[model samples]
Target: MSTLRMAAVSAPFGRDLEEDFARIGALIEQARGDGVGLLVLPEACLGGYLTDLDGAAELPPAFRVGGPEIARLAGLAGDMVVCAGFCETAGAKTYNSAVCVTGDGVLGVHRKVHQPLREDASYAAGDRFTAFDTPVGRIGMQICFDKAFPEAARAQALDGAKIVCSLSAWPTSATNRHPDPAQDRWTRRMDLFDRARALDNQLVWVASNQFGAFGAMRFAASAKVVDPGGEIVAWTEQREGLAVAEFDVDAVVDAARGGMDFLRDRRPDTYPATGGTPYVAA
Candidate 1:
């Protein structure tokens, strides 16, 4: 298999559509120069994330999946496979969504299924987890809080995803704040989730997050690429930059699963079914 160069971005984006596109264009040019074949941008990189998680925070502008914005994004992507987040609207409903694209147009899309804090007040929950084919490999996408759930990544892996891109606008702890954003507990949790999910599913993990501050929220920008063995291959720790890594996706994933084969040794039959009554000690 050919070596694939991928990057996860840690940069700030705001409510200004033109400003956001300018930033994105510059990043794409940078990635192109770095020979990146796959690029994952931060969640809500299109417009911006909520100012506060409180239900009162004004929502970002919503766009259609097939709107001009995505078309412009695809044009910027050209031949490169790019995954980015945006506020998507379908009729009266708005979703925190991610889309994968190239010059050929969209490859796949994922609506955020999990909502943290008061996020539900801003966007509707997604229904399912699915992986799709891309130039790099079979890729799956999940937004911010979705990575915390084991089932989310597990479902993608089960559906043949070799790489999972997690886009986040995750912020610092609301309470017990740390002076340095890097030292914050929420930042640690974000990193932990990336590593844990990669190890659990034995696939390549790429994570992108917002940098700097937006509204009352200060984001934790720890973008990274983790190997199937749960090792950090490349990272941009608490800063604005790109975490770039190059490797043969199939080779690494196969080698990781060769030993234990976590996916092959499942015992789903013994697992409790939905709504199954719990056993009580006598």
Candidate 2:
């Protein structure tokens, strides 16, 4: 039976490797008890996040790309693939990148494509798309704002990803409040990208986010698992606890084979990649 149980972590940004490792330890313990095979956490997890530190001399010096932080989290989980966000230093530039790790070792990494306002000022856009084979099924990762872009997730689907996991540090958006008619409309349009990717592609879209506030930056903590049909399976509105769910790889495979085959109906004839219009742009 092809199955992948996953955990989405949501907490404030931790300071150094020790702090991150401690959280990873707690995450591992929870995952172990839940029998989860995969764990996805928030963005910039290793290095603490603050819009003020764009070029302020890599604070800890220990916070470089593929630094000891990577090994620490990788070693923490015995047999699970963990996706975490951290700063990636290439040449003299720093990128908002996510590290993909498994039981054996790191399975490549992806830099964030579409960064926020301050993010673009700080991070260089990532050029590639990452899709890899996992014991559960083919999986992919795109962080925060990347989920708002269609192509980011669609590209993964095209790459044969049955499950696409998004690790985010989504700041609290005014539109995502108590569901009123107007709020409802706004929410759908906003989350439409996430839903479209899942429903249209017939793939599971796991949106794990860092909820609550890290000083001034706040995450909605609205992390949830959207099924292939675009229906949310399990999630949380507040960023306090952990959300865990067991998914059947067979179901995902079967779903992608049915009605909404986003991959099959691709208009590669006219359109380019899955990335469409900018969500924030009017």
Candidate 3:
């Protein structure tokens, strides 16, 4: 298929796993009915997200990567490619992870590399960023804070990821509050980062974010599907719904890069080293 129909969802998910699955199943079916071949769900959709950041040692729910929950998700995936997040248990350490799955099985898994706030207290940080092949295309994933770092998405771009699914539970700044999510600084940053990352890498960007309130945090639900040109084709601004868009992946990428191939034209040799490098004018 040259053109792939995709859906990015903005919805609230909590501690109830059964309820979560029901909601996910309904979303998947809804996307399927809309002729979507790929579906991207928000961060911590399976086991929900952290409610108390500064609390005690009690852990949030974590499941093994090869556990029954993933198997159930794989079964639900059916013919459509589904990307969703969960708290992953690998041995004794648990990481905030996202998985790409279809009827065949789990295609790829991304353990979120960047942890913000008290997230580190809950889950171990991932050490690497990698992209893998999926049914629709070569894809990469980044969780919440991961997208804030340009290197995270750039690494995937370097690995030849045509599409990047960024799952986030992003909320407004605790210090600065805006009545409208569209005017909120955090939401603005999220939207800007989404467009900039896509345009910077020249790749299709599928952004999904958690909606509604979780404790003191009120999530900014601006789920969207952005083209390589940094244009949002479809979006759900502070609402619980699906943002769907159709793309001929190759054609879109080709058109975007035809004029200026950022990856190919990159001058890595001129780049300074990380950690207190003197700024040099290019």
Candidate 4:
């Protein structure tokens, strides 16, 4: 299929695993009804996010990646592709992870690379960035703060990701919470990052974020689907809903990169060779 319908979600998730899965099922069914071939959900969609970054007492228990929860999610995914975030428990360590699944089984997974502030206290970070082939297309997944750094998305782009799904549980600035969370500086940064990342790599971007309040944090839900030209084709600005868009994946990418290939035009050899402090990868 040249043109594929996609849906990106902006919704609140809590510690109630059953409720979360129910909501996910509803969203997936809704997307399927809307003829969506792919659906992207927010980070921590499986379980609620941390109450606050200032060291919360208790966090949602981590789940094994190959456990029943992921299997149920995969079953619900059916034919349509789904990408959602969960706290992944591997051995004794837990990491913030995003998994892509279909009716058949797991497609790919990404452990968040960049942890902001006190996030490290809750979860381990991922060591690398990779793009993998999904039923929809070659895509990459990145969690919240990961989008802030140009390298994260670029790494996926260089690895042949035509589409990047960014799942975030982002919130308004704790110090200066804007009366309108949508207008907050952090929200602006999120928007800028989405567009910049899409434009920089000249690829399609699907950004899904959390909405509403959880503990002391209130999210700025700005889920959106950006075209290869860095324009929002569909968006839910601070609202809890799905932003839907359709595109002939390959055609869109080709048209945006026809004359100028951003990937090919890179001069990585001359870029600041002086290595400073490298980001800690999980």
Tens-digit lDDT track of model 2 for 25-126: 887788788888878887777765653323432332234545666777778766887888887787877778887787666776888888666556667789
How do the residues 61-134 of candidate 4 rate in per-residue lDDT, one tens digit apiece?
A: 67877889999999999999999999999988889999999989899999998988888898888998889998
Q: Give the TM-score ranking, best first.
A: 1, 4, 3, 2
Q: Whole-model lDDT, candidate 2?
A: 0.69
Ten contiguous residues with the weakest lDDT in model 2? 273-282
What TM-score should be assigned to candidate 1?
Answer: 0.96
Off by over 4 Å in 2: 52-65, 174-191, 272-282
In model 4, what lDDT does residue 219 have?
Answer: 92
- lDDT of model 1 at residue 232? 96
lDDT of 3 by residue, 85-194 (tens): 99999988989899999988899999988877777898898988788998899999999888899878888888878899999888887776998888999999999999
CA lDDT of each candidate? Answer: 0.93, 0.69, 0.89, 0.90
TM-score head-to-head 1 vs 4, winner: 1
What shift in Å separates residue 213 of candidate 4 from its native position after superposition? 0.5
Best by lDDT: 1
Q: Give each model a TM-score.
A: 0.96, 0.84, 0.95, 0.95
